[model samples]
Target: MILVLDFGGQYNQLIARRVRENHVYCEVHPHTMSLDRIREMAPKGIILTGGPNSVYQADSASCSPELFRLGIPVLGICYGSQLMAYLLGGRVETAPTSEYGKTEVTLRSGRSKLFAGVDTKTICWMSHTDYIAAAPDGFQITADTPVCPVAAMENEAENLYAVQFHPEVMHTVQGKVMLKNFVYAICGCAGDWKMDSFVRRTICELREKIGNGRALCALSGGVDSSVAAVLLSKAIGSQLTCVFVDHGLLRKDEGDQVEAVFGPNGPYDVHFVRVNAKDRFYQKLAGVTDPEQKRKIIGEEFIRVFEEEAKKIGAVDYLVQGTIYPDVIESGLGKSAVIKSHHNVGGLPDYVDFKEIVEPLRLLFKDEVRTAGRELGIPDYLVNRQPFPGPGLGIRIIGEVTEEKVRIVQEADAIYREEVAKAGVEGLGQYFAALTNMRSVGVMGDGRTYDYAIALRAVMTSDFMTAESAQLPWEVLQKTTSRIVNEVRGVNRVLYDCTGKPPATIEFE
Candidate 1:
């Protein structure tokens, strides 16, 4: 296994993900990890992640020199490269002009294994203020760029490599190729990590941990929970009970679909219970206009309901959750700042009655989760379902949420999805409709009508971190808008949201 030492970089998790994509298993640990603990895992290679600090700063983070004597391959990035240089008796200085975006690096020597198949000129995603001015006595300069002289360095004798750009990000054209070379060609990894292996190993581990004990899961009908439930069922069989609460905030036919998948005729046939607590949720959320407040209430109410159901189902030793890697990182699992408070991550109230919470998918990403789901015999329709927020339509409505607004938004959202699928628009990552509080005036067969407006959003993204607006064909939008305005009531005007994720989130509020 490969171990990635996290230095508080934003792309630390992305680096681990890339290594996994190469069919290699890896784990991320903070830089402050003790040297004795590192020796215990005995990883085949080590990767040093970048951070947002300069190496010259007195309070900057660095690794213990004893790590180099482990006789294992080591690869350092951005800040990691600077730290390696400064600690190994090399010079590191702040660049005259910091490189914050994409930059071109020119290869000086093609003999290094890291640059084996790389082109002479490659574009790299760079975000650094400090650069290596000189290599250590035994190191060789492998590449350079206009702004930085030591873009890449290597000491083949010691299996040490360093680069001043991020190879995990997709913006870097040859990033993945470089990682492939390092992991396979240089480090000699077998590349034997696959979804099947993960499934088999995880099942064995779960059985060992939850022996003869009952476990309960709160199913949200999303891909994460569905996959987690199926995994648990595979391990403990009838001992697993799934409680699905239809709080009336889900999309059209969502509850029925969940029931169909987990019912008596379904694949697993595990014990299941369905709760219709629509009125309770609506009443609790009444008079709450703030988005944060609504999310908090919804989260607390879910826990309360789950506790009530657990009592009815008898004693269970564990509570299963569908938490994934992104949820953990976004909730500040490491030194990273909390991007947002995900309900499944940080919304658990203090009134829970379970002995422990088991999250099988905590270390996997969305795509990896789906891969594992398919390996467990789940259908394609459920495994490939689009990403949905935990709070459901509560955050989709811009203003006050009422029965009328919910119905209107649900209809509009369904129509938008139907039309998009029919048009064969496969490139749009996620598409939905947001009910705006603003209304517009439109002519309805000679009558001037004023009603609520709907905003249609569609984005193209590989990772949900950054996205660009989907350039959908105008004809398709025209049909979608016409259908919503004519078929869905309380919507007079339909507008397309062209804003990306940075300026606007996928959901309105």
Candidate 2:
């Protein structure tokens, strides 16, 4: 298994995912983890993940000296690379000119394993105040940019390697190629890991872990939970009860798709329970202005309803979730600052009693989950479905959330997705319907009135964590906007979101 030592950077999980995508098993542990424990794990190769802190900081984090002498293949990224060099007696100094954003780095040695099938000049994402001014004793400097001299290095002769820039981010044009070279050429790991093998292994492992014990799962109809449900049902049969809380915030015809794939056509037993409390949710959300408060209310209420229904089925021994790697990283498990917490994170308010939890996809990526879904014969509707926020349509609505508001948003959102599908754009990251607070003047059958403004958002992202605004063809955008404005009632105006995923998240909230 590949070991990814985390320095608390946002891209740590993405690095592990890339390794796994290459058909090799990998585990992520904090730099604070014990060296003895890591040695026991016996990782085939080690990858150092980037972090927020500079190595120059007085109290920044660094790895033990023993980590460098592990005698295994090692790869470092961004701050981790700088740390590797610093720990090994390489000179690191604050750059007179710092490099950030997209920049080109030319390879110094063309006959190396790291540059296999990659272009001589590659576009890489760079962000650092300090850089490696000199290399370690036996390291070869292989790449450089205008800002940083020691941009890349290797000591493959001794199974040690390091790079000053990130190879996991999309801005790096040959990022995947560089990683493929590491996992394949250096690590010599066979590219045999696939969706079928992962599902089969997970099912066997889950069955052994929960032999005859009942497992209860929360279904949100997203790809992650739906795939987890199928995997668990295959392992424990009818012992799994899936509770889907309908807070009236899902997309058009979404509930039906969930029932169709995980319910009837599944290979395992599935007890489907749908709780529709649109009226209660709307009433409770009235006059709420804060987005975080709205998300908390939705989460808290969902838990209340789920536990109540769970009582009818008697005590469950386990709570299974489709929690993926990105969710865990964004949760900031061992990081300094709190980013954001998913519903399943931090546990049940320290009051509600539940048994041990099961998260099958805890170690997998978004693409891996979809692959597993397809392996289990899950239909295209659920397998290729776009991601929706956990807060559901509540976060998408700018003003107070109500049943009528959900209906309007749902209709408008449905129209937007259907039009996109009609345009045959297969791999878009996220598409959402936002109910803006602004009102627009409209004439319905010669009668003048003011109505809600509905905005359509769709973005393309190689990774769901960060994204750029999707540039829908002018014709496609015009068609989507016109259809929403004309066909969807109560939606008088339609607008496209132009902002990317930094200052604004995929969801407005």
Candidate 3:
């Protein structure tokens, strides 16, 4: 197993994701983790993540020098590199020119295992102000760039490596190759980690934890929740009860579709209860315009609904949620900025009746959740369904959410999806239509009219962390626009979002 020490970097999870892609299990922990605990975990390798602070700062994050003497392979990145160099008798100071973005680097050591198959000259993503001025004693300068002297350094005999540029980000031309070399070639990991083993181990763990106890699952019927439900069922069949809340924020006809799959007549062998609380949610969300406020209200209402259901079930011991890695990271992680609050994660209320809240898929990414779903033999239609946020279409509609607004956005989204599917647009990661909360003047049937506008968004991404706006076919966009403006009333204009994930998120709100 590889251990990624998070020094409050934004891309900490990305590092773990890359390691898992190499078929090696990895976990991310804060840099404040005790050395004794690190030894207890016995990881095959240790990766120190980048951060925003300089090693010279009075309160900067740092690990013990003994970490290097532990004999385990260690790789430091960006700020991590400066910390390693500073703690181990090396010079670290502000550079004459701070390197940011993609920079050209040249390798000085051809036999370096970290750059085994990498090119002599390559481009890497560099984001740092302080640079390693000098390598520690006995450490070789493996790579360097024009502005940065010690871009990469290593002490082969001690199994310590450091890179001033970020290797986890894709901007690095050969970042994956470098990471693969560190995980496999240098660390000697067998790379036997797979979804099947995760499934077996998680089921056993759930069974052992929830034995003779009643657990209620807040199943949304999305891939994550569906997989969590099935895993719990396989572990303890009747001890699990799934309560699917149809809060009316889902896609058009999604409530009934979810019921058809998990209801009494469905293939699964667990208790299923469907709650139609459309009015309840709409009432709670009435007159709420701020996105975060709407999210927290919806999140608290969901728990309230679940708490009532659990009371009916009598003596429930635990509450299960399908919160995943992206949800947790985007909500906020160890000094990282919060992009938005996921209803299941940051938006949750302060108090709850259950002894504990269980998230079976908490550490898994979106694709990893799908892999576990496939391993459990869930239907292809359910397993491959596009991801839907817990707050559902509430976040899709920008401003105040009303029943009429919900209907307009839902119909527009349905039509947009149908057209995209009909056109067979492959490789589109996620696509949805949102209400813009803006009214425009237009002429329809030779009469002047003012109606709301609908914005269509489509992105292509492997990990949801960073995404590029998909350039949809002109004909497809034109047809979708024409259909939404005509078929969906109250929408006079249709605009395609060309912004990517950095400036804008996948969802509108």
Clashes per candidate, residues 3 or more apart or on different chains: 0, 0, 0
Per-residue lDDT of model 3, residues 219-283, tens digit only: 99888899999999999899999999999998999998888889988888889999999999999
Per-residue lDDT value at 320 in model 3: 93
Q: List runs of model 2 lying over 4 Å from the truth.
A: 260-268, 336-338, 346-348, 439-451, 502-504
Which runs of model 3 end up more than 4 angstroms from their true locations?
Answer: 95-100
- TM-score of each model, in listed order: 0.91, 0.92, 0.95
Tens digits of per-residue lDDT for model 2, 17-106 = 888778887788888878788889877788988887878678888888688787878898988889988888898889889987788989
Candidate 3's TM-score reads 0.95
Clashing pairs in 3: none
Cα lDDT for residue 184, candidate 2: 86
Q: Give one digit per residue, the lDDT tens place, for model 1 in 266-379.
A: 766889889999889899888888887777788888878888998998888998989888777766767666666677776667667888889999888888999999999899
Error of 3 at 194 (Å): 1.7
> How many Å off is the CA of 145 in candidate 3?
3.7
lDDT of 1 at 283: 90
What's the residue-level lDDT of 35 in candidate 3?
A: 91
